[model samples]
Target: METETRDITITDIRKLLDEVTDPEIPVISIHDLGVLRDVRKEGDTFVITITPTYSGCPAMDMITLNIHGKLRAHHIPHFKVETQLAPAWTTDWMTDEGKRKLKEFGITPPMGSKGSEDLINRHPPCPFCNSENTELVSAFGSTACKALFRCRDCSEPFDYFKCH
Candidate 1:
């Protein structure tokens, strides 16, 4: 079975891509996570731009593969997945829905925008118990972009998606 590509619009492509979730954080789609930047049709090719949460993020490879798989599955024959690193990715780009999803998934989302002064001394509340009494267990969590934090009240360990 093939999807009718001739009538497909950029909006249609975006809807399809919304189904693609991040490999590391499955609760949020790439678009909400602020990874999927743009989707536009140029000539006959659809160009999809994505930015990594960080430059050296390991999930980029899997993300690209997933994007390709998604487009191919929808019979989108001509498309380009480009990784744009310039200007860099910031926590501010993440959607509010994405943050809520992250909390529901037991991970603390970045509380402030990247380079914000509050973020310098801020402690992320526990997603499970919403306690401000949290201690940094480790600067690095399961992934480089997250930090391991232990909630004093809940006594639960959670990963905080670091700002920037």
Candidate 2:
């Protein structure tokens, strides 16, 4: 029988990744938003795969740094951050816990696509009032990934997770 030693470990690094948060929206972890794809050991280094919420969303730089910082603290010295664009990051990939956290953070969760059309046709519920009487204030919110919404019942403005 022969003994083998693995120089790199991934499970621990992946666990520490939860500490990294979106710089713009601290309440959401990059992982929770479905941005983080995978972390694997590649020889003496690490391969981190991430998908951006949108093609040109500006939060990517900070997201990368946050992940790296967390990884480095966990002793993952050599790592590569790779961007994976397809099958692309979709609102559908958002987890139940992620949705609940978003609502608790005052952002509504996105519903599934209503049709074959590429546009986001489903109206998101208001996080504050949970009212369906919500209207789109604008398709673009403070961030390109989110839509601006107003709750008719509560007369409060909120960000809708509905996005293409």
Candidate 3:
């Protein structure tokens, strides 16, 4: 008897997912956000794990569709994407690399320790100038995903991912 092998690998999934940029920030990928939890082969298909940036984030739909669409285009047959919120995704989960990409894309990423209590703290330095002279303009930004803020030193408005 002969056994069948699969070409669907995590690398393939990651590569395909690399094509999935955050809808809000096209330069940064969802994987960069620490969103792509796990990609592994399971039987004849693949299994992907993801965590939502927030509980009510509407982008979840787009994310799922993106995974399916891209993988399907690559001729990937069957797969399952499991969403886990146990360690609910937070801005703090955003990696250093992700931050750099955000800055390069003209969007200021969130500052230190993303926690509910921490969001109200006024001491986070401006990601643009590394200055402590920044103020929160509003509690919301482009989407429920972010907040509006202005840097006192740079005098520029920026978005801060709501650390939910």
Poorly placed runs, candidate 3 (over 4 Å): 1-5, 118-120, 127-130
**Candidate with the greatest lDDT versus the true structure:** 1
Q: For model 1, what is the C-alpha lDDT against the true structure?
A: 0.88
Please provide, for model 3 over 1-164, each residue's C-alpha lDDT reduced to its tens digit, 9 standing for 90 to 100.
22233644678678889899777677788888878878878778688888988667788878888888887777776788888877777777777888899877656677657667445556456667877787888887888777777888989787766654
Better of 1 and 2 by TM-score: 1
User: Which has the better lDDT: candidate 1, or candidate 3?
Assistant: 1
Task: Give the Cα lDDT of each candidate.
Answer: 0.88, 0.76, 0.75
Query: What is candidate 1's lDDT per residue for 70-137, written digit by digit as tens?
Result: 98988888899998987788989999999999999999998766863333356799999899998888
TM-score of decoy 1: 0.93
* TM-score ranking of the models: 1, 2, 3
Tens-place lDDT per residue, model 2, 12-56, is 667777778777678877778888899887676678899988778
TM-score of each: 0.93, 0.86, 0.84
Residue 51 of model 3 has an lDDT of 91
Instruction: For candidate 3, give the lDDT of residue 143.
Output: 81
